[model samples]
Target: MTEIWQRPWWFTNSSKPLLQPTWSYLLDNHGSLLHSHLFSALFPAAAYFVICTWFSCLMLIGPSQWRVPRPQILAVGHRSPSERECVVHTLLLSLFFVLPAAVLQSVLRTHIELPSRAPTILELGMGLMASLLLFDTQYFVWHGLHHVCPGLYRSVHAKHHQDHSGLELPISLAHLLPWGLYGGPAYHDKHHKSHKWHLAPYFIHWDRLAGTLAP
Candidate 1:
């Protein structure tokens, strides 16, 4: 039997075709179409629209009690955006940012040499941890700057604050308190209330070190 590392990363020893025949045919013959703006951008944009629309609809029609248990983060006398406004902004994000970025990334990916080796379980775990740490640090700094800089806050980050309700996922995972150094939805809800804190998404180390952890 061939060793695991000898095969491609996506393969098992069985060497089966993971993708559908239609997709494999397109990838073999019309590869550029998969990398085209139609597939890379428009498809993702449409998917985003569907997901956001579905989530919005659920939040609208679902019982309020089904939402995650957390204190409302809106300031006194502050009003949350209406459903229409949320829908508009979500659509705008998909069209302008998500679509363009997807196409750009597809173009760039063709130039990049992707990893072909199957990572060991330990390596996979280590890679995931490294990614989380790097992302947490990057976001911590970026989020802090957005708060301290008035113009940057207004132009870049203020739109994110528009939905201060912090009911994004609306799952009942509230009981799973922010443990394991991971910020649960409740922990993130705290950030919406106290914007200067809980800046990192995956790990709490940066927030603790920067003294930005919520009290």
Candidate 2:
């Protein structure tokens, strides 16, 4: 097997300067690694958002088995804030979140192993779960804080609760507006109803465990 090595100065000193990333230490940088581009940072993020948005639209709006099972819970044929507003707002906010996320992804993917990666299935699962837990914990805490302070909720969060189905928000920019799952109107509606409950955008148990769960 062939091995590649980066210049010594390319490495940055961290808390553990000797400990390189498992993937980098193992496989080094293969020729197949993605080269980071100044202009291309946001492309991957935008593409991911577009694919997810369109997929949610086709699944929920169009006829498909993936449609919400309890149709009664959903507000059918409902519209709010007009289509133009949704598009404009979504595009604007996408610029805010997508740029940073794309840059981060680009950095992570730039030196990925070509044929063999260090993260095994278990490692990947554990990392994913850790990220989810961290995100959910932060979400749960901030959500509680926002609601507890009337000024905070009224000034910013109020716009989110405007519509039960998140139609008032945009599909792509929900995470930025902090109103995720707006594309999945059915699930997202559950979040807006009865602020005492359904606080998680990903439907995590943070709200319930925090003793904030109420009808």
Candidate 3:
């Protein structure tokens, strides 16, 4: 069996995230579409489904004595987010990530040599860690900048902040890089309360480091 890289080739030590033999095979065969759907839609939907179900269960099973307050919104304005919008936006968002990676991989395949072998489990773990690091830094920086920049906040992010009442999976996970286990509503709810919690990639250290952590 071929070993996959710990991270995508580009993010890996190999410096060839795009130029790998496995990717060509993965993308060209029937398996490619399946992989694309899995990455772009199915897997994320699964997370959505699970999180929703979990919360539903909580509402159903949690102690009756425990009362939760109505969610409070920021000064920007308060409005319930649209579920339809979240799902549609999320699907399109997934495509953006999937398509670019595919195109880059295809383009690189013609010019560069393949990786020595698939990344081993350890290597893949390392790659995951590396990906998380990159995503978090970029996520926080991007989110922070948007918060500080009124034009950006008003134009693009305001739409995102509009729906603070419930968990909108697609919109919640629609970050430039938000496919991880952490990219769901529970963690993201903090952002809705105030732009102070839940920086991207689901990691707290960066927020804490930046002193933006509300905890």
Candidate 4:
């Protein structure tokens, strides 16, 4: 058996076709559509609108919960890059991490057999719902751990919180390196601290199953 890490980016285990490989195929196809939309005027405008809206919401809602006292933010940066630089660098690093994971998932799908019959629209909807729920659960658990533990938080998770303190961005494994190495506490810490509210991130189920969730 190939080590999970050693498996080719495209190789999924043969037995779990629907569960593992299907997700990649679906996401890749969906992403392709989204990419194509970038060439059209409407999509870019819509995307910008959505991004702006999201940022606005974060600024208004996230600060109350995610903001560390200015002193805490400054203290964490003692041996690291400035907050602005850290955010930019970590964001770039996260993109690098996510791109490969996405490619690997796509490669894994190539090893599986796709549905022989066209999936009914209902089946597609069900699959999407299931995937989303699973992802959220895993993300929440994984994120919670970056706060509950300190040693693991510092070495593998603190990188994200090194400068910033907040849950403005959607959390995911891709963001882990940034959060892990830099400082944000999976963004959950902010929510926990601010509102005592705990909601799951979108992709939490996978991390939980993979044993990568912090707590």
Candidate 5:
């Protein structure tokens, strides 16, 4: 008698044979070695890049702009994120978006072979341009959504605006829900609050939209 674990879920003593079995049958027979190597490498790299870029930008740019203020080390009776929660949130973001996109890119590259070429300075510039476009799109989509959808604004976006003053608040460290829904509104909130004092716009063409050259 075949072991229950070894047999397919659909297989039974009286069941008819399948004409075309599922892909899982092929995988079970052939094993995962048939999977492309490019997929494995690209996934982790993409995950690392996204997480690092977001965290770095938040820490470096947010602080300099005074969006996130330095917390007083000596302050007492304040509710902050636990170390474990921070790590978990970071991991969740990396796994959900970054890793999946990288995997898809790798799988596409493997399945559809492209011309091999060496990296050049022009390629680097193109990559930078692409990154900027991606950031801008994300920012604009986020901001527009907030303006259009008041329900989303009240639940998630409200946390960002809670900080009235632009200086010295941990804007990035606020709820992760906002980041998931509206990308970079916490940073934008600072720009909105300090429109007069701020120098350059963070992402959106707020000056052009508002019809003011100055920040």
Candidate 6:
């Protein structure tokens, strides 16, 4: 008898695959190895470049009205890394962390059981909310700890706060105004500016309960 981990979920145990035949055939051949390499590594890296490029272009050449109204957040006389520097750093990060992690996930894929059927709407919604909450909780804890511990802040988190090494933040168009409930771009921008509050990424309640929510 096949082990439970070797089979799909009970509801979707039908012979039909969730994916179309051509795609299913490809998955049967290469499976998670191809998926991880293509999606987890290459797709994300490619997306980062493309999205960052768009952001840079928009900020540099787009209408002045579209720019963030706040004064430049960098401290006086502080120099942010140049475009080339950011690109080099991103490449190194992708090579060392992203690619290796994807490869590792692919290698371990067989040990993990996944549902074969497409999720119901309710399941999808629940999963998204769960993911958001989990991410927010983890982010809040880690970020708060870094701020509270001077050594951790100086050694690791300082560069992230100072240099704004991540380009993903600027991709969100909602930077002009803070969301009432969710931690929108403006919420995250406030955190970047203050570096002492708004540590939670999705829910504002975490910061509120922790007394770290900024006005």
Q: How many residue pairs clash in each candidate?
A: 0, 0, 12, 27, 3, 0
Q: Which runs of model 4 end up more than 4 angstroms from their true locations?
A: 1-87, 104-110, 116-121, 159-199, 202-215
Superposition error at 36 for model 3 (Å): 14
Query: Higher-lDDT candidate among 2 and 3?
Result: 3
Instruction: Give me the runs in candidate 3 sitting further than 4 Å from their true place.
Output: 1-70, 74-78, 91-112, 164-185
Give the poorly placed runs of model 6, Cα more than 4 Å off.
1-77, 99-110, 165-179
* Per-prediction CA RMSD (Å): 5.5, 11.5, 10.0, 14.2, 18.7, 8.1
* lDDT winner, 2 or 4: 2
What is the C-alpha lDDT profile of model 5 across 137-188, one tens digit per residue?
5655565566558898676544333322233344432333342332243544
For all predicted structures, in order, the TM-scores are 0.64, 0.52, 0.52, 0.39, 0.42, 0.63
The better candidate by lDDT, 3 or 6, is 6
Model 5 residue runs over 4 Å out of place are: 1-84, 97-112, 154-207, 210-214
- True-vs-predicted CA distance for residue 43, candidate 3, Å: 13
**Span of 10 residues, lowest total lDDT, candidate 1:** 111-120
Best by lDDT: 1
Model 1 error, position 33 (Å): 3.6
Winner on TM-score between 2 and 3 is 2
- Give each model's whole-structure lDDT: 0.68, 0.53, 0.58, 0.49, 0.48, 0.64
Q: How would you encode candidate 4's per-residue C-alpha lDDT over 5-90 as one tens digit per residue?
A: 67543443444444445556655666455344222334434454456456545655674654334324434337645655754654
Ranking by lDDT: 1, 6, 3, 2, 4, 5
lDDT of 3 by residue, 132-205 (tens): 77978887888888888999999777766664333333333334444444444555666777676766647666
- Structure candidate 2, residue pairs in collision: none
Reference-based lDDT, residue 82, model 5: 48
lDDT of 2 at 112: 36
True-vs-predicted CA distance for residue 52, candidate 1, Å: 2.6
